[model samples]
Target: MRTGILSEVEDMIVDEVPIALVYNGISHAVMMATPADLEEFALGFSLSEGIIAHAGECYGIEVENGPGGVSVELEIASAAFMALKERRRSLAGRTGCGLCGVDSLDQVCRPLPALAPARGFHAAGVRQALGAIGARQELTRLTGAAHAAAWCGMDGVLRIVREDVGRHNALDKVIGAMARGKADPHDGFLLITSRVSFEMAQKASLAGVSALVGMSAPTLAAVELAERAGMTLLAFARGDNFVCYAHPQHLAVDT
Candidate 1:
């Protein structure tokens, strides 16, 4: 028996597929993600995961669809490939799980470089980006289940936006797109529609992004990481209100 209030209706849902990041014929990790902007995801994951030091070290990337799922094969410089092998561990990724399949605790936190101080950032710019980003999120508008990551100029212009079933994947996609486009990381801020976590902060710092803004609160670990990295971290950002978690000095208050 069907309830009167419940009726069958067709609905659109976000797609989450298994994405394998294969390096030098070695399967390194697998993640659940939306099958869009995958090339950027691959590049971003590589850089953030420290698989390669720079984009130039990545010689090529190939995406293959198979019965299991999509596999992103990356060809990188021998040096980088060697480093990857040394730290090689299979990651059994789940949606939004940043740390999975790590064999030991030692690998949990990798050392990161201190970020250069961000400049020209204002609270008003954060508000402006927050207001404009919703309109640019096509996937979220369609599926309502996708998370978004956007690259925004200090002036509050949304330059690039990427969406995925997993927040981390979305961040990786936008970071990859930014690198592929040769955008200077220091010149802009990263806005994500997810809580700021340690891995999220780590990835942004690795990309040399000086500022990271989020639509939700940040974890304590994330706050500490951002503080040490000298990154300006903000969360719980809505129209005109936001909480600064780290390096508030970098963000100028708009009068």
Candidate 2:
């Protein structure tokens, strides 16, 4: 089971608070997320925001389990540290919501640069990856209060997984881990246990992964982003059927 403090159902209150990520003694953005996998959350946040190009850019990560929640102290490279500081300086703390803190509607729906078109991925392999994702979800299964993002290979091998209360956070964690571990994002597919959003699609593209599969629907913005990125976007993926939104040519559906 996922390691997290649990309260009985009906009495369970979702733990949400400001998690301040500090990089090389400089304060970065504060995210409101559940108090678990905080270290992963910090690294993931850093990667998704383009604060750190790779995991190795983070020299160290220290988690302080505090009263209200947790604080992540990250020792990042000088280059990434400067970028993080610039980002924080641009934010209006009072107006910014922790999860969706982009400048405007257009920024919120930023497009991903087009990538190499995907090779047709087998349906059976995709199904196997979906099942693997379900099995690896320790936190979500325990609290019924988390989202998961996984990186699975073309042959259904799950390379890495991350979980968070916020879907975006979960995806960030996965991407961060991949970058840190130097894993081959191009070797596999990306899967989410939540609906596909433009941000999610953007992150996947930035990670250079070619396909995304989700258990729910994709927003119109997300679909458009996937199309621009030349990535396959699969939604409503269930027992034997899935809706291919963009790049249907990349899916290996059977006769």
Q: Highest TM-score among the candidates is held by which one? A: 1
Put down candidate 1 lDDT per residue, 23-139, tens digits, no spaces: 989988889999998999999999998878899999999999999899999999999988777655343333444465344567777787878888798898898999999999988
lDDT of 2: 0.79
- Among all windows of ten consecutive residues in candidate 1, which has the lowest summed lDDT? 89-98
RMSD of each: 3.2, 5.1
In candidate 2, what are the lDDT values of residues 1-255, reduced to their tens digit? Answer: 236866554534456677888778766567778777677778877777677777778898998877766678999898877766666666655473534445554556444555776554778878888777878987777778888888888877788887778898888888877776777666788989999987788889888788899999899988988888889899998776788999888778668
> What number of backbone clashes does candidate 1 have, counting pairs of residues 3 or more apart or in separate chains?
0
Q: How does each model score on TM-score?
A: 0.92, 0.84
